[model samples]
Target: MRLDERIVPYLHMAGLYHLVRLNETWFRSDESLVSAFMERWRPETHMFHMPFGKCTITLQDMAYQLGLPIDGNYVSGCLMDFERYIKGGHPAWMRFEELLGVLPLANCIDKFTVKCSWMQETFGKLPHGVNDATVKRYARAYTMMLLGTQLFGDKFGTCLHIR
Candidate 1:
């Protein structure tokens, strides 16, 4: 089977996991996994995070500081490898930094199942097959994958987590 076709099952799983934990806050007020990941990549590129108030810090806050829409859903940057991609085109256009927050790998099963499922769901929901007006109205939702951060994990080890 083609790679895209094979990825569906995992994406479905990710979607399921996402649904199960829709209200769960996965970040902390201090240095966290997501922060660490951002710090690791930020210095390597043009991205930078601005400081904010509140003892509480989360992806949404970080996204806001980085210029991403705090209201949009996130997908794994790893999905860029797929042949089919929807470039965001809208009022709440998803920014490159918005996708910087990737789905975490809890275990091998979580990596291939939960995370992939979420990415698949997000991809399917991307704006497509619409009229010109609709397209123009939602330009930000149709972001091109030409420029995106790629998520990678250790290939030689079986630790499961990307870090």
Candidate 2:
């Protein structure tokens, strides 16, 4: 199947209506909003929205499209990995914590840290050439966008930098 066909459906599935609407409002080009969202959203979480529903298009699906099995749980695993990555003194974690517009939940942070450590130890194998710093920033920005989308929806306009 075509890449766009595969992804557009997922965007629709992931309940990213706001994101799609944002693309229409902000960027008046025929560009791939899904690609932009993936690049800007949580790059670590290998999931995107379907073009028509609230289901997610996972990296496993993409891998399957490339003739592999959808056997890995990389996306969900990454969430925990991220918690550890943050606990490990990733500068971007500080930035993200600030950007979320909420004071760090001290108790939650501690708990999350332990969970993240377990995830890292379990699925911690690194991908080749994955720069830690770049991943950190991207994860932060993606997280910001995800939260911002939830908080503001389409009501806040361009007050948040989505691009």
lDDT on C-alpha atoms for all candidate structures: 0.32, 0.38
Q: Which stretches of candidate 2 lie over 4 Å from their true place?
A: 1-128, 161-163
Cα RMSD for candidates in order:
17.6, 15.7
Q: What lDDT tens digits, residue by residue, belong to model 2 across residues 1-163?
A: 0112223443444444334433334545333653455444443554444455334556566555333335544333354445454445555436444543223334324422312222223223423465555334333443334434433323322223221
lDDT of 1 by residue, 125-148 (tens): 434465554332222211221011
* Model 1 lDDT on a 0 to 1 scale: 0.32
TM-score of each: 0.18, 0.21
Poorest stretch of ten by lDDT in candidate 2: 1-10
Ten-residue segment with the worst summed lDDT in candidate 1?
141-150
Question: What is the lDDT for 138 in model 2?
Answer: 34
